[model samples]
Target: MKIIADLHTHTIASTHAYNTILEMVHYAAQAGLKAIALTDHGRRMPGAPGDWYFQNLATVPRRLEGVLVLRGIEMNIIDYEGNTDLEENAKNLDWAVASIHGGLMDPNVKPTVELCTELWLKVAQNPMVRVIGHSGTPQFAYDYEKVIPEFGRQGKLVEINEHSFLVRKSSVPNCKKIAEVCKKYGVPIVVDSDAHFCTELGVYPNAERMLKEIDFPEELIVNGDENRLYEYLRKYTKVLEEE
Candidate 1:
């Protein structure tokens, strides 16, 4: 499938990210992407945008350089209870990506993979979470069987982050497992560059290769079509409004 929308990206507003919204838009357009989401790091991260920044996202154009722009957050899962640091602002965004950011998740002395998986399952079940980003990271290990099936039932997407696979060596094996489980459960998967700069946007050839290697079905990749993406965005926006 030809993936056209990259739903996980970061802007300069996210501490370590190096791009601006305008720069991302330009790069996405040049790369022929139909849409992109600006999912800055959670408020807990140093130098992350403040509440006002997210609340004022309306000022940003929905369409920039002929590409749809989605305002979102990569919220940190702060506790085993599945609480996120940006709970108050989460419901107001265009999309929400609930993730385990290492520092935020409290293992509570257990620190077992099963315990972490259980916590993530709780986060996935939350209506506010639209996507579970970078689940393949060993640092925040989770059972794909339990998580993927439930995520599918809840209409949430599971991410195959390119950067995670590139930076975290252990992510390769886990990502393969994630793909297999997602396929088995008929869960939709989103491949993202997890790009922090404009030049990196929509650059997922490596991820595409991995998906192909796993023999993952094309239809399961959510970013494969623009029409479906717009439809999902509409539904997602409605959910945010009701929150």
Candidate 2:
């Protein structure tokens, strides 16, 4: 199976991520990817771009260097109630990937499976969320049986993030389990680079390997075919009308 689109990535605007938006897009084009999402970090992360940054994303061309560019955010889910750093003014973003991060949850508050499961159920109902990004961090494991089906019902693509393998190795085991559960429930999924640098754009060897090992069904992966991805964007996101 091939991933024609990579719907989660970071740029220099995220503060710690190393590449510029154009650099990442260029790499996506070079890698021969049909589409890519430039999802910088949302507010709440220290030094993350302000609301103005996301609000001004309309200025970015819908297509860049022959690659479809999705102007979006990897929004940090801030509480057990599933609140995120997404500002009202930034709601027009073409795509969104909700994620759990350090600053959002209190360090002393243990990440119990029950609490995390509750959190994600709320996220699944959010209209602004199109993808559930990298949610299998060992600390933030959720109740897969209950949530995976809801994710499918809500059209939220569960992400298999490549960066987790290299930077957050602890997530690997749960990621496989999540993929397995997603398959079991016929939940749609996306494989993303979650790339912090230009060189990593469109790279998904680790994520691909996990799915191949599980003999994951190609049709369930949103990015497995260009038309499948385009069909998803048309139904669930505000992308694809870009000229």
Candidate 3:
């Protein structure tokens, strides 16, 4: 299968990431990507953009240098209850991806897995959320069985983050488990670079290899087709409007 879109990525606005918006666009074009999302870190992160950045996203064109540009944010799940730091502003963006960062989840907390999973489902069910980024990361041990079906029912995409696999080796088994649950539930998965620099944008060969190794269904991966993604985005936009 041929995948053309990378839906999870960061820009200079994210403190730890390295690259400007223009640089990201240029690299994505060079990489032959049809579309990409600018999912910079949420406000809770040290170098994340301010409220003004999200509010003025309209200034950035929907397409840049022959590639579709999706204005988005990777919001932090602020609590086990699934409340996000930028919940109020999420509605305005083209796409909003909810994720678990260091501050939002306490690994030592009792019932960490159960609570985190419950919260993930809550966030997935929220009308404003289009995707759940890096749900497989071991640091936040969400209940895969419950979360996968919840995402399927809500038409939300579960991300298979490329960087997470290399950066968090301990989470490999958890990621495989999540993928298995998604397959059983018929939930679609989105493979993303989760790249923080121009060099990393649109790089999904590692994820592709992993999925192939597991004999994953091509139909469940959204990055394989641009038209399908446009349809998905339309539904996502509708959800945002309703919110």
**Which of the numbered candidates is closest to the native, going by highest lDDT?**
2
Candidate 1, residues 104-138: lDDT per residue as tens digits? 55545545678777887788778878888887777
Clashing pairs in 1: none
| Candidate 3: 10-residue stretch with minimal lDDT | 234-243
Give candidate 1 regions above 4 Å deviation: 107-110, 239-243
lDDT of 3 by residue, 1-243 (tens): 777888889988887888988999999999999988999888887778898888788788887898888889998888778888775755678888888876655556654788877888789778777888887766678778877888988988988888887786777777778888888888999988889888987777767787887888988887888777877877657422432
Q: What TM-score does prediction 3 earn?
A: 0.93
What is candidate 1's local distance difference test score? Answer: 0.82
- Model 1: ten consecutive residues of lowest lDDT: 234-243
Error of 2 at 31 (Å): 0.2
Where does candidate 2 stray beyond 4 Å? none
Ten-residue stretch with the least lDDT total in model 2: 234-243
* Candidate 2 C-alpha lDDT tens digits along 1-243: 778888999899998999888888899999989998889988888879999999999999998899998989999999999999899998999899999985568788888999999999999999999999998898898999999999999889999999999988999999999999999999999999998888887788899988999999999999989989989988877676655
lDDT of candidate model 3 versus the reference: 0.82
